[model samples]
Target: MRVVIVGAGEVGSNIAASLADSHDVVVVDVDPDRVEELNYSLDVLAIHGDGAAIETLEEADAGSADLLIASTDHDETNLATCGTSKVLGDAFTIARVKHVGFLRTWERSSGAFGVDFMVCSNLLTAEDIVQIIGLPAAVDVEWFANGLVQMAEFEIGPESHLVGQTVQEADQFDLLTFAAILRNGDVELPRGDSTLDAGDRIVVIGPPERVYQFATTASPNDAATDTENVFVVGGGEIGFQTARLLQERGIKPRLIEEDPDRAREVAETLSDTLVFQFDATDTEALERENFGAADTVVAALDSDQENLLVSLLAKRLGVNQTIAVVETGEYRDVFEAVGVDVAVNPRVVTAEEITRITREETTEKLTFIEDDRAEVIEVEVDEKSALAGEMIRESIPRLPKGVVVGAIAREQELVSPRGDTVIEVGDHVVLFVDERVAEEVTSSV
Candidate 1:
């Protein structure tokens, strides 16, 4: 498939990189530096021009492209880019916008703004934050196989019970698979003798209940508070949406906003949420509210530095979990490294969501781990699948080396992927694949 992407920023670059290996990709950016960077770094054609302009699309040969993605930071520019692409080709148009109002408008009319699909970054980011809050010890969480299979990444803190345990000793859950151990930014395929470390992030896949059990076992102290008491430190759209989502689930969350006007506005909007106008970085205010005893505290400030400071403060005050919204993808690791439990990047989430649409038929669910260093994908075995009629041991050897068959769902039942287990057609399989071999594994598995 030929794909034309607009705005060569993080989101556009991410989408292009993911699709460049499998499809014809052309990136359009107003910045000459970004276009030049793409030309030298990726296997895609880079054009310098405003993508919302018709002449720019024509120069990029958008008329023959299979898909057109508008991923600029500005909402109107993205919508305009999609509309312009429609005039040039019948390509499926996707627009990435940060406001939920545009998504609501698009949903009301099927092809509003000439966009075939729309992604709301704020809403997506809020959903990501809420999911992390749901799983106490998890830095990331994804569900697959119609919610039967689960994928989670947990950071093993110094207080965790499993910090010093070996993979063999920690293998108490029969239905779970220790997919990969991430230590010091390196992905390690675990052996029975691999020992868990305090700062290591362990990726696991299994049934939802079993994964939840493992999470509790790994961080017993973190899981003790549950999801009852929650605190949100921002009045931005993402924080408001997160509080609203928690309210929907019957959990009233307290929110702190520095700006008095924004705090009043959110207070009026969220009936269940308690909005307080105060600087979250103020140690005295947090203590007065008993924030230390809360089960979870989400730092969603606009500035990355402020969010980092607030997250660390919450951790020092004894908050069970601290999840922060990181605008820049590069700051994610830094935040997590400095004691933030989970760093949610809106751009990364949007890019992954858009890339997901390009490969929807190949996988039921997909999520990028550690900023696209690895991926956990759930795919079904069809008649054309390479591993359809072979045993687990026989088929795995034929695939790429990084592939690990985590679990299988057959007829609504969890099938443990043993060496001798036979993988029949129509069975859904969850696999952890290194990013280097992901494209090959996705095609052949």
Candidate 2:
């Protein structure tokens, strides 16, 4: 497949890198340096021109492309690029935007902007924050098999009691599957005897309730049975959406916005939420409001630096969980390493959501961990599936070394992937696969 990606920013580059290996990728960028850099760094052909211009599309031969993605930072620019691409070709166009209004407009008529699919980064990032907050000590959370199966990543602190326990000892939850252990920076397949270590980021998949239960074991003190008193530090679109979603879940959170006008606007919009006008950097003001009493503090400020500062402040003030929205996807690790419990990157969220739509028909859901070191993907079992009609242990030999069958959803019931469990046709299997074996594992399964 030939893919044309507009904008050479983080989102566009990530999409290009992921698809470049298996498909013909052409990247169009207004920046000459980015175009030149992409040409040297990746296999894609990068063209220097305005992506929304007809001449640029013609030069890139986008009319014959199989897929066209517009991911510029500017929503108008991305929409215009997609509209232009439609004039050039019948490619399945995907546009990334930051506004919910555009998404609503497109939803009424999906092809309104000539975009086959649209991704709202702000909304996606906020939903991610809400989901992660719902789980205890979860660095990431993704649902598969129509919400029948769940995958989550948890970090084991240096003081965690599970540091020295083997995988077998840590397997206390009935429906949970220990997918893989992320030690240092590498992926390690979990074995019965595999010993847990401090600072290990472990991935688990199972029923949603069991996954939430395992979180208590992962971080007992921080994992609460109920999430109450969430603190949202921004009144931007993401923060507003997050607070609104939490309100819908019956959580009335306190929101702080530096701009008085925006705070007033948000307060008027969300009746359940309490909005305040104050700078998050003002420690005295935060202290007066009992910031330490919050179980979770989400920093969705306009800038990543501000969000990081607010998150660190929340941690310093004794907030159990601090979630921040990172504008740049690459800064996620940096934010996490410094004490942010979870750093939500809008670009990464949008890119991964877009990438999932580009997968094969068999793959129902896909999400990457630590930006592609590993992946948790859902695929349907067919007659040609290697594991079809076979017990999991019997099919292990056919799978790659790094593959772990996490969970299975047969019809509407959850099927635990035990050694003796049989995988029948039409079963949706969610598996954690190391990046090294993704292609081979997906092919065989």
For residues 1-445, write the lDDT of model 2, one tens digit per residue.
Answer: 8999999899999999888888899999999999999999999999999999999999999999999999989999889988998898899999999999999999999599898999999999999999988576799998898888889999988767788999999999987999999987899888999999878999999999899888888888866646788999999999999999999989999999989899999999999999989988999999999997799999998898999989998988889899999987779899999999999989989989898889856487899987788889998999999989999998977777888899989998988789999999999999998888787787788
Best by lDDT: 1
Candidate 2 deviant stretches above 4 angstroms: none
Local distance difference test, each candidate = 0.91, 0.90
Q: Lowest summed lDDT over 10 consecutive residues: which window, candidate 1?
A: 217-226
Clashes of 1: 0
C-alpha positional error of residue 228 in candidate 2 after TM-score superposition, expressed in Å: 1.4
C-alpha lDDT of residue 212 in model 1: 86
TM-score of the candidate numbered 1? 0.96
In terms of lDDT, model 2 sits at 0.90
